[model samples]
Target: MSTTTTAVINLDVPGPTISRHVYGHFAEHLGRCIYGGFWVGEDSDIPNEGGIRLDVVEALRALSIPNLRWPGGCFADDYHWRDGVGPREDRPRMVNSHWGDVVEDNSFGTHEFMKLCELLGAEPYVNGNVGSGTVREMSEWVEYLTRGDDSPMASLRREHGQDEPWKVPFFGIGNEAWGCGGNMDAQHYASLARQYGTYVRNHGENQVYKIAAGANVDDYTWTETLMKALSCLGCSRTPNNFFQGLSLHYYTHTGPWEDKGDATSFTREEYYLTMKRAARIEELVRGHAAIMDCYDPERTVGLIVDEWGTWWNVEEGTNPGFLYQQNTLRDALVATVHFDVFHAFADRVAMANIAQTVNVLQAMILTDPDSGALVLTPTYHVFEMNTGHHDAQQLPVHLKGDLPTREVEGSALNLLSASASTKGDTALVSLSNLDAEGPRTVVLDLRGRAVSAFSARLLGASDIQAHNTPEVPDAVAPVLHTGIRTHALGLEVDLPAHSYVTVSLELAP
Candidate 1:
């Protein structure tokens, strides 16, 4: 029998309201991501804002990044906020034991990070040290940032130069409690979260968002323990508040950490497997939400996938710890699929940050500091292409037929993913064609919605391994699409194989 496949996208059914934080990026003090990639020192020829590279800032601004998470991934637990304050020379030089074992000068501290956020017009989501630090340490850190009074920490903040307190709303109690962030069980971490959260005071007009370290991928037991424990905390007659959001971390990679697949070159099987892992995020979010539902049926708690993206083997000759990998159409496809999934569960998944913003796993920006060359990766294109979904009301979509599914070990994942949004008189539809081989023509059923004009943009490559380099910058960028139009029934567009397409339509009068 000859095989035939098609995709049907319904623009009538919308998803949840997409959070602005979904467009967030992460900047950790690991590898060269901060020093070489972003920070170039104020004295250098490279234009900078308090030592942060201006070129890098402009590039991130183009992405309209909503928020930037800072100061550690695994390093957050080991960091002491005080060490990063005061004079640059007076600051202690500490060895980064988790990352490269290199000495860090503590130049880029809390002040520098908030300054960078301000320059980019992005919100700061600071992760606190809980594994090695005390409750006083975490509480004082919060006071130093948000407190604007004569308190000890606030006084210290003035003494440092900033007389006024910074506006830092999002604070993570800890990160990855199961691994580098203190080897503790869910119950242990939950108790630790409660203690740290109780002391994390919100001074001034800034509202604090306390995030608890949540489960890894598919670790349902952790979520179950967290929900049950936090529920008890919520039910406390003493009136105590513990957490505002639960943080989850997951990476989409085909092989083990040591043997992660190459970023630029891969066979069809590898591409298929990588996308399979990417699509699993939908299942992960749904499963985590199910646990949250059992405990908090009112949906008061938020699910924050704080760390996510494609993690693969490092580029040739690059330091493995540096996590420098080439971005390609494959990564672009991965981003589209993940974003669509997040939108589907937008009510529960409030925020998510791509892992290691620049010069790291599936990075949106890559820099050659020596040559002063800055390049946006394929993943960046995906973000720019789908920016319409940011803060847009989710429109419901209905698919009449079954979308093809890929089977893995007796499990299956839908081949096509889609989401829709409407703002003002314009309706936007973004879809991902996850099929590896032939193109799929999707009949976009608009459900009798008046459509005046329509246009589309597509990011795809002839081969799955196709990538853009400094020499060939436009290898896999988005092409301005003009194929589909609005009819009385709907619209029809042919989605190229392994492509992400965004269609914008003008509502008719």
Candidate 2:
């Protein structure tokens, strides 16, 4: 392979507006992500708030998580609201069947999840069961959570012990209807979405955001079908809206689910493929957004990428059905790059939640429930470091050189990824070098803005396989460097290979 290098000291491109929800995360009942990860039951010795672990709550609060999707990927479609309400002993118990086939006690229902969202100060985007649920079932769920008066569902909520409604505004019609949810075609699912969404009421103060199940990856036809169907509904001379947002799910993996690449060990080949998959999210969003444009020129409906993140084989000796994976510096770069790309298309991409928030897949925080110890993963650091990008205006940056590329299958991805935002007199630049080896010299020309000083916090590891364990917690943490000098036309910094760095520049007086 031939070596490649690129340099552009000062190039300007318009920054995209960043959405607050892009920093959102997901927690499903599928694994320890909920049972042992975020919720350990109030009776346990662990510190908790109404059964939710206090430590987990504090950690997530620190991330400023804006939204959290719950109940599941496939579990949502199988879920029945009635079974998760009323007395615990009376609440029905059903086999997860889709996940580990473990029996679910329905202890954590609508009330518990809404309360958890309140504690985290996040908007609760509940995935309503549509594939296997009747329209009345979903409509009652909306009424139960949002109705304030003595309506049938509101009476049931009061009878269940929670008198006040929980004001949940975002609702997903189903999850992955093309596969796990029901395996329905785009045209068929579109009609089903219209019927189910029609009855979801926005009771007082809550302007419900109903989201339809979207395409998996690059299935543009799904977006086309949804947008066309919704457009037809909008002009049907009816007084109701079918849906507000469309959802898409994508995971970065190298092989089939059964033979996914190792989480902690990989050759340069594997590293390249992972980043390549991560970079494809940009194209996926753009392609889907383009279809939405053709069918709905008014941009009436939004795009919600509610499920996305790395999906690898389970850790050694861990429950294979749990989908647990170790978090490494590679995961941090993936998070940073993915967030930057999402920010670039903020107008169309209204909200996105990482696949699993904790203890499963590419989690931000992991816990040792047995010991009650919490570990912040590399992905967590990336979120903490880039949190400044939340609600920040995306500033455009131009690049002129041919950077190195990582090849996968037959496609190649640029090794350098970057996003810039300016708030007040401070300009923040986030850059990621996805190459597996060798440092990349980045020439950031900040002549127009008059930068006085520059500093950065970088996250990298000696090897792509390096990860954080309970014993080696600092294996991959951000290293802060201060008092950087700027000379000539711009600033030049050596970005470590396979690293994510955030540079903050102070504007000259």
Candidate 3:
């Protein structure tokens, strides 16, 4: 029997506009993500633009990725901006102690990254080195990237051939300061964040949105400490001038961190567990937001989920430290659910960047090592399908009646997750069915607007473990869904198990 769920979308009463930056991506200096993934060298046979991978850029651009975070997850702490600029050949090589202990040839440095951003039309979100770097070094890097005048750092940028200063809209203070970035306590890191963020000045109209690293999974104390320290009471001074956002890092793993389940070989139990973990982001966001409300009630300080997505065991024969994993139907569902959560709390979550893009954990495009062939993963299709929601006014979705549920670990998990947003005259409603073995029916009770017609697209596979590969790239791709029908209230959608669907409505005036 197919379970049915009802949702009422209030279109006229629109909520906060979902920031397009929420659909952002992360590219770290780990494994093939930067080396063979995005940068194949100007001399290599792969198609590239000034050493930046053109295909990867084109694929990401198609999804309209708003921003790209560069350099490191942990590597940002050890990185020095000077080593990556000047001349590519003369740039110094350093060891990537964070990922596989691999030696990084300074070929893809600051200039190459900014150039890559330009090609993809994505705003640069550079993570500054704060763990091991001095304040002076961090300060100059900002001047080098955003200074338009002939300042010392800006002059050096011109010396490297970039005549104009590049715009950096987003800047991360550090990553995982509680763990990898630096093992600092909450209070200690909060103080350091204010200190480091102080010097990350705005140079020549390039105002950077500084995001300080916040808590891990459920450490509300870290968020509280940062909020209390950064928030000013009864004073004219505000928090945004110093730092505008706080960062949260969370990953959906099937099992314990010591033994993250295989991406394609997960059991039914593990699949549900992964979904349960993915759904917990709502709790984390609410908890952190509550703390922020106590401090900055105006919601000036944005919550940035800078590091997210699934983290499964590395594929066979791959380097363990690389954090490589296959993207399956399960992973795509995870992505959809996360987007729904982001939209529900659009007023709080200003931005979110999926962990690492390309050949890493929950990547969009996976490249073949031998032939350099590119394969678009299932998760990529989800992002491409939901592009309509970017910067759109969020429509409040109220789910009514008994919802479908799956039991896991003595608790019930809602099998249906949904969110809707409107841009112009069109509205996009995204739905996810988390059940692994049965179909589900969703009847959207559209309100405040009349819909003349609608179209739908679906991304799913016969099995939850199905994924894309070089030989069969479209194995889990999206296709136009014909199972939608006009309902008495609005419309009815039949969703397959472990699937994601997006409906586009032609609203009537």
Candidate 4:
């Protein structure tokens, strides 16, 4: 039987403005995300701009990605920036122990990354190597990029090709410090965060927003201690270098991290459990944000979810270190749910990055090696459909209706997720249904605002496991949705099972 649900959108009630940075993407030095997936030799047959895949660059720019985090997850800590600069041939080769343990030729260096940011028109968020490096190394790296002054680093920059300084807005001190980044306790890491963050110089008008490594998953103690310690230290003198934002990393998994189920071969039961875990991010963000509020009531310290998205076993017969997997309809639903949660907490959550954007977990696009083919995944479709939310003011959604639930492990899981936003002359209402069966009838009330006209797009497939492949690139693309109905009271639409829909309304003139 088809289930009926309703939500009241109070357009008259204003809410927090959503930061476009919240929809940012991350590209680590892991797997095909860098080498063949995004970067190839300029002489290759594939179409590219200065060795970067042209298709990949255009595909990401279409989404209007606000920022791109670079260097590493754990890789950023071990990476020596000096080894990656200068002439490509003269650059040293290093073993990528965190990824595949393969030899990195250092072909794509600092110039290549900053160029990528320029191509995509995204702000560069570089993660400094704090775990295994000294403060001098971190400071010099900044000076090399930001200093127009004739410092040693800047002089070397002129020796290389580019003479101008590149602007770096977001700078992360470390990543996952509680585990991979030196495994220090909260107090110890807090001291390092303050000390290391102190030396990161801000040159010219480019003010660096220093983000500190935060909690892993539900480590509230880590959040509490870091906030408390930093708060006490700030009592004496307030410095912009010390932790402008606190980062949190959480990857949704079908099961435990050690045995995260296969990305492409998961059962319906496994999918339900994974959504349950993904939905838990609301609690994680809210809990951590509340702790920050205690220490920073004015919301000076922003909550940044820099590392997030689903992680699962890599494809069979592939390099395990590559972290390559297929993006399915389930991943699209997960992305929708996570975005809604971020929008719901827009007051505190300033920025977020879907981990490993191109070819890693929950990647937006996948590139095939044998055929040099590019395919946009289901998650990609979701992002494209909801691009209207960028830099838009959020409208509080007052959902008060009976929602269908799926029974999983003696629990009733809600099947619907939604968020709304307004920008310029239009409004966007995005909705998703996680139920594997039974379409949902969503009766929406856009109170206080009259809709002159409306259009919609839906991204879904018949099967939950439907995904894209190099051979079949258009497997799960967005289709024009004409299921919307306008009336005196509100608007109504049929949300298909295992689907995501976005309704763009033209406000009454």
Candidate 5:
């Protein structure tokens, strides 16, 4: 016998339109994420478009990625833009001191990065060097990319190949000033953020959204201090000011950052622990948003969850600095939980970016060098399935019955997480069943709204540890879910265990 659960959802009562930027991805200078993972060189046998892997491009394009945060996580703060421009051969070689202790040839630089964004049709969110670079260097870097007229930086850009200025939508002033970006206290980083941001001027038609480096997990003092600093500058919950975004960095892990558990295989206890950690993001955002509310009640500045994703012990023999890990069904559920939280706070949580897009922690696409194989992770399918919710108006969803909890070892975990959105005549419902043992019945009360047609795709696995390997890339993939049924009040769908499912319905026949 199957138990029933009803969720009340009214499309007329909309909350906020989920910003497409919430679905952004990140690419860093760390590991093969930029080199072997994305760029394989023009002379290499790997299939590529202008040195970038064509297969990787096509895969990311499928997600309709809104924006891409690039250059670094820590690498961004120390990175000098000058070292990356000019001829590829003449570009100075340097040590990647931040990641892997490997040598960087400066092969893929500013122009190459911009070209990749052009290919993917994505907006580039460039991070300036604050810890190691000067204010002039930071200002010139922006000028080179966005300045339209004939100036020093603009002239240099033309000499480098880009004749016309490129429109840069988002610009992060620094990375983690609390730690990697700089070892500055809240007041110090706040001072530098304002000074550097002031000179980073708007060029041509490019209205760059300035993002200040924000807090780490549970660092309420940092958010409070930064907001207080900006508030002192007469920047408080208003449009057209010194700060447009404030970023926070957090990763989901069971233990300390050093011992984040395994990637592919794990105990049932670890599984529940992972979800428990995922829930911490809500606490972090709420606490930080509350601080922002105290400072900027108008909610002009966006709470940018710029860096987030699953972090685990590096694969068996992979370089620890590379931060590579396999994506499994558990990660898919983790991602849906994240999107659910972001959607719930869509009004103020303006944007978010997964840690690393290609080969780093919790990546969407995995690329193999030996076989030159390209595989889409289960998390990738979650993003693909939820693409409809992008820019869609978020609707209120009320669960009538309490969520069924399952005891894994000694941990009690709630079973379901969901969010609803509507775009014109179409309504999309995203559901996640975190239970690893049995299926879940989710009865949705559509509030007298009749659906003319309904369809869904589920990203699931029989085993929570199941993942895609190079040889069997299709081991876990999305399939059409057919458990949706209509009854008296509304409809109910049988969500399989360990699955992230998206339902699409057309209300008008």
Candidate 6:
């Protein structure tokens, strides 16, 4: 039986404006995410502009990705910026010890990344090296990327070819200093952030929003330790001036870290377990936000969830360290619910980046190694559908009726998830049905505005394991949803099991 769930959206009373950066993407130097996925080299047969793949850029451009975080997750800690500048051939090669022990040719460096960001129209968020790098090295990098020609580092950049200084809107002190970035305690890492972030200077017009590494999962103390570091009792610096945002890293997966279940081949029970884990992000965000509230009640310091997404075991036969996983219909639902939470907490949560953009964990685009053929994953479709909500005013979604729920590990799991936002005269409503075997009837009680008409798009498949392959790229793509009807309060729609639907409401003036 299709359970009916009614969600009332108060358009009259809107909350914070959802920052478009909340839908940002991450591109680390892991697996083919950089080597073959994004940077295919200027010499390659793939249609590219200045070594960056044009197809991938075109696809992501449609999604209007606001910002792109780069260079490393863990790789940032060991990455030295100088080696990647100057002549491409003269640049030294180094082993990517953190990921696959493969050698990195240093072809895609600061200039290439900046050029790529220019092509994609995304603000660049550079993660500086701190794990094994010196403060001087990181400080020089900021000068090189943002200073005027008078600065020494900027002059060096001119010698390498880029005469104009690039604007760096976002910067990270380090990545996961608790583990891969460095094995330091929270207090120790917090001190380093103050020191490192202090020198991440604003050269002329380019100002960087420095993000400090915060907690791992449920480590509220990590946030507290960092917040405590902002003690300006004796100093001239205020808490807001110390660091603009604190970072959190979380990934959803089923089973132990050593034995995460397969991405596609999962049982009904495992699927439910995976959804239950994915749903815990709301709890995690709220936990960290509550801690932030205790310190900065004015909410000046933003919570940056820089690393997040589903981390499944690598596809069979793939390198274990590469962290490659197939993106499926299940992955789409995970992205859907995550956006809902991000929208709800738009005030506190400043920015977020999915684990990767291509050829990695819960990737948006997957490229074939041999053919260079690209396939847009189901997760990509969700981002494209939700693009309308970028920088839109968030509306409160209240569930008036009994929420469709299921028992997972002795806990009630919400089967229907949703978020809504308004931009100009139209409002975008994103909905997801998490049940793997059952459909849902959802009544959207839209208040505060009269809806003249509406159109919806649905993304789903016959099987939960449905994914887009190079040969069958459109297998799991979105189609115009015809299962919707208009009503006085709002609209009623039917959502399929394990599916994601987005409604575009044309609000009457």
Q: Tell me, what's the RMSD of every candidate?
A: 2.5, 2.8, 1.3, 1.7, 1.8, 1.7
Candidate 4 residue pairs in backbone clash:
none
Q: Residues 1-509, candidate 4, lDDT per residue (tens digit)? A: 66778888976665888899988999988999988877986998988888887889999999998999989899888889989888888999998888989889888878899989999999999999888989999999999999897899999988988799999999999888888888888889988988989888898877899999999988998988878756743354442347889899999887766878988788888989988888889989999998887777767788899988889889888998899988899998999999999999889999999987888988998988888888999999888887889889998776677867777767777789999998877889999888887788888888877788889899989998899987778879999998889755588889988889999988874
* Residues 1-509 of candidate 1: C-alpha lDDT, one tens digit per residue: 11223334444455567898987889988777898888888897888877999988998888888999988688999899899999998999888888778899999998899899999999999999988889999999999999988999999989999999999879998999999999998899988998899998889898898888999999999998878766743353322368888988999888887898888878887888888888889889999998887777667788999999999888898876788889889898899888888888888988999987888787888887577678888899998987788888777555555466777535775667787887767788887878888676667777545777889998888988788777787888889876565543577777777888999988864
TM-score of each: 0.95, 0.93, 0.98, 0.97, 0.97, 0.98
Worst 10-residue lDDT window, candidate 1 = 1-10
**Candidates, ranked, lDDT:** 6, 3, 4, 5, 1, 2
RMSD of 6: 1.7
Which is better, 2 or 5, measured by lDDT? Answer: 5
In each prediction, how many residue pairs overlap at the backbone (N, C-alpha, C within less than 3 A)? Answer: 7, 6, 0, 0, 0, 0
lDDT computed for candidate 1 = 0.83
- Angstrom error of the Cα, residue 121, model 5: value is 0.9
lDDT to native, each model = 0.83, 0.82, 0.90, 0.87, 0.87, 0.91
Q: What is the lDDT, from 0 to 100, of the residue 440 in candidate 6?
A: 92
Candidate 6 residue-wise lDDT, 1-509, digit = tens? 88888989977677899999999999999999999988999999999999899999999999998999999799999899999999999999999999999999999999999999999999999999989998999899999999986779988999999888899999999999999988999989999999998899988998889999889999999998898787432333447575899998889999899988899999989988989998999999999998877777777789999998999999999999899899999889999989999999999999999989999999999998988789999999999999999999998888868688899989999888999999888899989999998999889998888888899999999999999999999989999999999766679999988999999999888
Of models 1 and 3, which has the larger lDDT? Answer: 3
lDDT of 2 at 337: 78
* Segments in model 2 whose C-alpha atoms lie over 4 Å from true places: 1-16, 232-240, 482-484
Q: Mind giving the per-residue lDDT tens digits that candidate 5 earns over 1-509?
A: 45656778896677789999999989999998999988999998988888988888999999999999989789998788899999898989989888999989999989989989999988999988998888899899999999999999999999988999998999998899988888899989989988999988998889989999999988999988878766743454354466688999989988776688998889987898888778668889999999888778888789999999899999998999898899998888889999998998888899999988998999999988678888899889888898898999998778767577766436666677889999888899998888777788888888646688888878887899999988888778998988888867667788887787888988863
Instruction: Answer with 3 or 6, whichever has the higher lDDT.
Output: 6
Among the numbered candidates, top lDDT falls to: 6
Stretches off by above 4 angstroms in model 4 are 232-241
For candidate 1, the TM-score is: 0.95
Which structure is stronger by lDDT: 4 or 6? 6
